[model samples]
Target: MTTLAGKTVVVTGVSKGIGAAVAAAMVAAGARVIGHYGRDRAGAETAVAGAADGQATLISADFHDMAAVDAFWDDCRAAAGGRIDTLVNNAGIMRQTGGIPDPIEDWDAVWSETMTVNVHAPARLLRHAVRDWLDAGKGGSIIGIGSWAATRGTSNPRAIAYAASKAAITAATKTVARNYADRGILAYVIAPGVVRTQMSVDSAEAVGGEAAVTAGLPMGEWVPPEDIGALCAFLAEGRARHLTGSTIDLNGAAYIR
Candidate 1:
């Protein structure tokens, strides 16, 4: 069985969705987790409550706000206790008015918000993780939570900003993977589509419903968060570390490229 026993992993956006599932899965696999959340204290606490004994810690930060984002890394550094084995960049946002197709000021604000939280925040956190790994002289991995939209544009033009932000960050992740592999820092991207999370369900509803979302896919079902969580656990083990710059698409056969 794959295991991360005695390792320390940082998973952001653990208040819910795939982030929460990853945190729980890593803790279950015997790794200590620092689960980051935005505002949901109870949800954050709940995400790690089932962790093995005391293997999880909940950290809070609003990725939308730069000040809080910076301070969060400070606190995460302290929580690392000098060594960090892995980091899962999972926190992201997609406003209903996310794109700037409309030249209006309101659409511009939405576009900015999506990029700030989805791309810029993760970049800041990645810098800190890379620095720590370099300082400790230990090999570690980074798991970036991307989306299928990063590779294939979404049907909803309103989410163009969200798609663009993810694509940019995924490319950055690949670059880091290639450039830093010799330095023992690895990066990988998992781009998923139509995940069975609250956000996905809400988005499906906005368009039609669960059935509408599933019917569009060949599998006729949504990819569960636990599946992504399990995949993350496997990659975090470093067994397939050579696949650092690869992008694993988990779209339930909705989009193949």
Candidate 2:
């Protein structure tokens, strides 16, 4: 079992889905988690419950707003008493629009919203964390939640913007690892194919249906959110520092390189 004892971790979008699971997993691993939730306070509370040593705190911030992202980072650091050991950039969006056939107005709106929520917001927080880590001379870890769609183009053309945003972040994460490895900074990407989340369910409906999507997977089942959470916790431990800069696929061999 991985233990994050005495570590302070920050997880964005902790209200539900992958973010919630990551937060819960880290807490159970004995890390003090500072979770960010957009609107669902109750859900965030539930996710952090039963934390090892009961040291979990929740903050609220709308990812679409750049200024709010900065505030969230500052507040998270304050809650962690000016030290954050790990940051899990797990908040994102996949709009059902932005396809080639979409109306111009709809396409533009979907692309804008998806980029803001999925890329800009998380990147902003990462920037802040990296700067703080450098200033303190205490290197940290970053675990970005990317998707297999980032490398393997999505079959649903409507998700073009979503895939693009994920690719951008994945590149940024690898760049960080490359530049900061000597300084003790670690970064990794968890690229899941079809996670069992409401987002995946919606995407499945857009392509065909959940049954069809599942049948096409080699494992014949969607990846569980808990599995991703476990991976996040292990990465957060930063035990295998040599694994930094790697994008670990959690898609059950659906899109292997």
Candidate 3:
């Protein structure tokens, strides 16, 4: 219902999972999408092929690398054919390892990669893309994909670094919103609970059966990627202008705040 016709949206991590679903949803809404992938060119090309006419373009960049991150913005700018109207910071890393006798290298890798993709890269991209738009007195929307771990303490011991990284994202969202609100650039965070992605399924299996884990949810099921995609679509539209600086939870009653 929220039409994004003529608008250009850049979604990172679009090779698969929620990123791919969000890109598809945006294309369905009539928005021209720039699907950003690190090394999954084949997957990104296939995704674009499945989209509507002139709906999606595949862009490649490694968020963990600063040089690649800069070049990515340039590529996105060029692909958008002008300014980027919507920026979806969806690329993130989740490692399930750590706690007592935790390996220092594992912690470093998780923390570093998480901060780079989930925090630093998004922050930098926003600074580059939104600054001129804001300066020129044009408004835009920025959505950061956060995790429910940012709120509740995870029982899964291996998720400490990931959780911490997401919390930082939520904080960055608020800061960006405050700093850019007057310029009409809004920022928001979508923190989803355990979704039925392959990663979640694997984690669930490691602890127990997927059904058993999902039964704990008040909704009695894991949140689907499409559901999150819908919310992201809404936030990317100008209709949610008043909802800036907020972190909306999509946990389906699991870890309700």
Candidate 4:
């Protein structure tokens, strides 16, 4: 029975998958949500449609573009009525064709795209959120969506860049928690092993197949995105401030460490 009533949460990548689920969960907790979608307006709309009017607002931004990332923060603040209680960094990209065996140029392109969308974009957004909270002298919460690939290397050789980007962001998230906890600003990382998102399914296909991936998992099923959504909502409540700087893993015991 976590309550986020009267809170404002900003969730990026609200178009689909974990982002959409997080937005829905936040709305369900009675928090006003400022949701960011890359390009899928319809998906974004569907995610928050369950909320009462004025409970959610959707903004579109291409995270690959730094300017858009900046604009997104401005727009998100405006949508939240100038105050955001929580920031959820959920948008990310995993290039499925960037292994060392690939052509040099292709590898470079994949790494660049993956890092820009996954690491750089979230870093920029974190900066904006932290600075704004400092200026307002109010505490805020950060929920960074990370991956198990960050801790245990991904089996998919093509996703080396993806793993690297996630690890980088995880470190950055911990840094934030260490530096800002005394100010009441809390930061956490959610490292999911293999959620049932399309992204994971696609990655499975690239490695071997869905069957192979599932067999390797301790649980016979993929981690549901709803679980992630629920955890995001719980963290947004800021109930467990001591959990700040912790990386909560939701891999169904597949890659526990």
Candidate 5:
């Protein structure tokens, strides 16, 4: 039982999927959440809805726009009353895009966009949180929502960029954990396999079918998004602080590296 009473957290991509689940779990754990979304206010609203403590606030932002990212952070700071204790960098985009044999321009566009939102956006938020925590003389946690691709490369050539981006964050997260552990700044990466999200369903369908994807996993089923959320809450607890800079795998025994 992780208790986060009075703690404030900012969760990205809360419009749906894992982000939404994470927000709900955080609220259940008694943490205030500043949920970020783009064009899905209804989804974000539901994510923060029914909180036991009434601490979930929704903010909108487009990751494609860097200025929007900055503005979103400003809004989060205000909403959180400058007391952000944890950042769940959960917002991400997985593109079933141009493959190795695709046109050069097609590959370039997908690669660039994937890197921008998946890597650059989260990296920016992590930097901001670190700076603010340093100035306030407080310790904080950064949870990176990476993928199993960050470790075992994906078979989908179309998602090459996605795997590469996740890999980048995994390494960057380890670096942050090494450098800031002394400062009580903990960083971790939750690398999950096929989660039960629309995005994962689509990706599975692209390969063949859900059954095919499931049979590949040792668990023979897709992972629930809340599992990641539960881990987020667990990691946020004081007891798990010593596991900083670790990459927690949630792939259901698919790849045991």
Candidate 6:
């Protein structure tokens, strides 16, 4: 049997990148996935179409808006037959700003948006999910998509807000795991290093050469988004409950801690 057979999963930011990959992987593993998107409705639909026949449902929500997040969950719960077994909070934005001097407006925009999507929305979603689990007397898994920047401070000042937001997510994951352990819910964070996403490629080009930046990695290659998705799938399947409350690093020896 598939590892996630009959499971119901909710994955945010499913329009593209890591979120899309995780949603697709879960559906392939026999889970019924609710693929959440913000504006990329076409991309979300493509992801669902690529899934194993009838394996996924698509929902749209502007995660930055609390009301939209609530409605997203409502639709997800209904699609999942009233039970959400796994949640993958993977929506995020990365603004690359060199250490060069910048106006306060730039800093404010990045910080505000990053915190809203990376920290606030996920926390609120977790709170609601925990309540639902308690009400239903069932357990579930929550996987937060974090970044290596959480541990390794960004060299660029423009990325400060992004790093801080992800760091907050890491701490939040631990808190949720600790408080909900006895209640039967598991929370874990996955911090990916330099993944070879479109964004990464663009950043590499903008910063000079991709090889020059990736040469620092022990693996000498950019990590794939699917790698993170696979790890998340394992966590959501409860295969390693003992590993709950942990931060699994996927940075290819970039940040060993």
Candidate number of the best lDDT: 4
* Candidate 2: stretches off by over 4 Å: 52-54
> Using Cα atoms with residue i matched to residue i, what is each candidate's TM-score against the true structure?
0.95, 0.98, 0.93, 0.99, 0.97, 0.94
Candidate 6, position 215, lDDT: 77
105 in model 1: Cα distance from truth in Å?
2.2
User: What are the Cα lDDT values of the candidates?
Assistant: 0.87, 0.92, 0.81, 0.93, 0.88, 0.83
Q: Which ten residues in a row have the lowest lDDT in candidate 1?
A: 97-106
Clashes of each: 0, 0, 0, 0, 0, 0
Give a tens-digit lDDT track for model 4, residues 163-252.
Answer: 999999999999999999999999999999889888998899987899999998887999999899999999999889999999999999
List, residue by residue over 1-257, the lDDT tens digit for candidate 5: 78998899999999899999999899889998899998999999898886855588888899988888888999999998888899999988888876798898989999999988998888888888998988988899999999998788887777889899999877887888999888889999999988999988877766788888888888878899999999998887757888998899898888777
Question: What would the per-residue lDDT of candidate 6 be over residues 1-257, giving only the tens digit for each residue?
Answer: 33898888999988888887888788778788888898899988866676776678888888789888888888888898899998898988777752237677777777888888889898888888888998998899889999888988764455778889999988988898999888899999998888878766755664556887787778889999889888888888887887889989898888886
Task: Measure candidate 5: CA RMSD.
Answer: 1.1
TM-score, prediction 1:
0.95
> How would the candidate models be sorted by lDDT, starting from the highest?
4, 2, 5, 1, 6, 3
lDDT by residue (1-257, candidate 2, tens digit) is: 99999899999989899998999899889999999998999999989987755499899999999999988888988899999999999999888887999999999999999989998998898899899999999899999999999998898888999999999999999999999988889999999999999999999998889999999999999999999999999989888899999999999988879
Between candidates 2 and 6, the lDDT winner: 2
Q: Candidate 5: misplaced stretches above 4 Å?
A: 52-54
Candidate 4's clash total is 0
> For residue 9, what is the lDDT in candidate 3?
93
State each model's C-alpha RMSD to the native.
1.5, 1.0, 1.7, 0.7, 1.1, 1.8
For candidate 3, give the lDDT of residue 47. Answer: 55
Candidate 2 weakest ten by summed lDDT: 45-54
Off by over 4 Å in 6: 97-100, 205-207
